[model samples]
Target chain A: MIPLDETDKNILNAIQFDFPLDVKPFEKLGEQLEIKEEELLRRIQRLNAAGAIRRIGPIINTKKLGGVSTLAAVSVPEANIDKVAEYINQYPEVSHNYLRPDKYNIWFTVSADDENRLNEILEDIEKETDCPLINLPTVRLFKIGVMFNIR
Target chain B: MKDIYIQLLRITQDGIPFTSRPFKDAAAELNISEEEVVDLIRKMQSEGIIRRFGASIGHRVLGITANAMCTWNVPDERVEEVGKIMAGFSEVTHCYERPRYPDWPYNLFTMVHSYTEEDCIRTAEDISKATGIEDYKLLFSEKEFKKTGIRI
Candidate 1:
């Protein structure tokens, strides 16, 4: 486990929303927390190693990136669920996949460069997996984004 | 540790309290001290089990330009390297490798964000160039019926 002091917490909280777009963003963050850049980087690295920080990077707006996103579901035989999932997991288009206790047992989110490619991939998966595909793309995007609170 | 971590996930997925004293209110509901809740959250963050405790923004309201899910046919030998490289992009969110079906030819998947569809396409093209993977697919979101953090 990683040890976090009040300063570390403060630094994390400050960066979550206000990650500066500067030459040395961490340096600015360190200045805010009254800590050395080297020390702050060290702490962040330690926290990441401990899994506290999954990543330290900019959060971009994907929707603005000119692509389509969708939540797709597939009904796979229980016996072949793992195999199918393994196959689905091999694609980079799939963002998240889960095994739900529903008729649509396997659900995942797919984002692609365009609508055509997305449909093509889905159709391919359906044909190969021998499982029916239910393409439930987002009709309305309700909400998206991650919030990391320090306190 | 497992149980507590699950509880933490449940709490976050259920949604953080939307109040000035959100932690205090959450503690009250869970029958724990506010201080305890805060401590637990801190611990969870430090442990990396809980990546971050924050808000889920409304992209539509913010007028996001575009977003798409791009899948690549990464060789099994270089899956990890490609995944790491894809994750390095600030515009790419939710990068993971899913299994490919006979019908589903591509394997590496990444979600890219931009201000417009053209931008997303350009980014995907750039990624294609960078990764040197010619065969891949792009799936755009048609509708988001329900999107929420799982409470389990």
Candidate 2:
């Protein structure tokens, strides 16, 4: 892992939320960090290449965009986990899939444009995987955001 | 909302181009002024349709290898109180109240991130101690099957 300095940490923290939207957003960001615009851009590029910055962009609210989503879990035998996960992952709606340590070993969040599309994907997965799945849709979204202090 | 605004969203769903004049590039493609694109984005933020404009990081690549979906079986009467407490923690990134199922009694879910598995477990224990809710379980991700932002 690349060791992050104070400047890098500050940059990461600032860019995580409310990144400037000006013609020269990086320049504005550099002003906040007390660094040169060129240097800031270079560091951001390096960070992106290093896989630290997954993507630099606007995070659209899926629900606001008329998408129906739910958290679902399934249990696959140990031997068929990879194959089953691969099959489930083929659906574009099935995002944030993970293998958890529990009876419901495979958990994932799926999102689709509408209720019909969402159910179609779920039904397809259940039939293909031949595993009973549980759907745990969020009744109330109290909070949804992730920000880590690099410092 | 105008058709132009929807077009802009389509252009930006993946991300803003990584360039100095990113908005300008977007405007050029849509045959609109850069100022208009910025104005629309600003308007969207004010409307709460866009939560925040920012960069997403690979937390695992940054040494945050452990994550747990900590579920709490808080009573219906106290779910709101306990949920607010859980949501207050910096380590608790996503917190929600979901419907309980048969043989699955957890009603509250909180996603916690830590540098190690021990740290994650400790966070879960600390949450329980703070909330005074004994019925809880920590589900750690043994493997990441897939992860992608919701596409509109």
Candidate 3:
């Protein structure tokens, strides 16, 4: 594990949810974190290089951004899981595909520009995989906050 | 989203650069003032189009290795209540209520991230006991083929 000092932990905690929307946001945030803007930037760069920070940017609401996404699950035979997952990965719309130990093991997300596009992509994937896929669209988002308490 | 904002989203999808004058780059690319770019960001945030604007963390990098999708078959009446209860836990990162398939009765889905599988089991059990929901299964991700999140 990449060792994170107190300042690094504080920086992650401070900026995970909101980066100030201002002309000089790092300056304002640095003031709150009691660190110089340059030092904070240096630390941010280090953390980012270490793969601690995946990206420093906006997490757009895909659905609100005029697109649709659904969490889909399909049970592929053990031998076909790899081939099916590799096939599904060809689509840029798919994300977070995982193999879990269950009947419906292959779980993925199919996000598209619209409902029609989403359905078409799913149908094409199902036709290739030859496994019935269940689309579980989120009816209500209770919480999506992903603030990690870096200790 | 307005045409102007769509332009902004495409430009800023990689996120604002890490610099003193961060928005200037995006603003200059879009041929707008930095102040205007910030204003559009604020507007989109208020409109709920920009869910969040900050660091996207890699939990595993933070020593959070084990993660599982714990799906609960919450009763229709208790979905909202159980959802809140489940989401209140700091360990639970994502909690959502989705449709219950005929063969699969799990409706309330939660993502639990922890340090180990034992921690996940303990936390899931604690959650089940707290909510009094018996029918649930913990689906641990054996291998993550893709997790780079959606791009513009």
User: Which candidate number would show the highest TM-score if scored against the true structure?
Assistant: 3
Chain B TM-score per candidate, please.
0.79, 0.89, 0.92
lDDT of 2 by residue, A66-98 (tens): 778999888789999999999989887788999
| Count of backbone collisions within predicted model 1 | 71
For each prediction in turn, the share of the native Cα contacts (below 8 Å between chains A and B) that it retains comes to 0.01, 0.77, 0.88
Stretches of candidate 2 off by over 4 Å are none
Which 10-residue window of candidate 1 chain B scores lowest in summed lDDT?
B143-152
Q: What is the C-alpha lDDT profile of model 1 across A1-151, one tens digit per residue? A: 3456787677656656665433355677678788888887777666555556544332333444456777777888889888888788777777777665345577787778899989988998899999988776543221233443333
- The i-RMS of every model, in angstroms, reads 14.9, 1.8, 1.5
Q: What DockQ do the predictions score, one after another?
A: 0.05, 0.70, 0.78
- On DockQ, the stronger of 2 and 3 is 3
Interface RMSD of 3: 1.5
- CAPRI-style grade of the A/B interface in model 1: incorrect
Q: Could you tell me which residue pairs clash in candidate 2?
A: none
User: TM-score for the second chain in candidate 2?
Assistant: 0.89
| Backbone clash pairs in model 2 (N, Cα, C under 3 Å; residues 3+ apart or in different chains), count | 0
lDDT of 1 at B93: 62
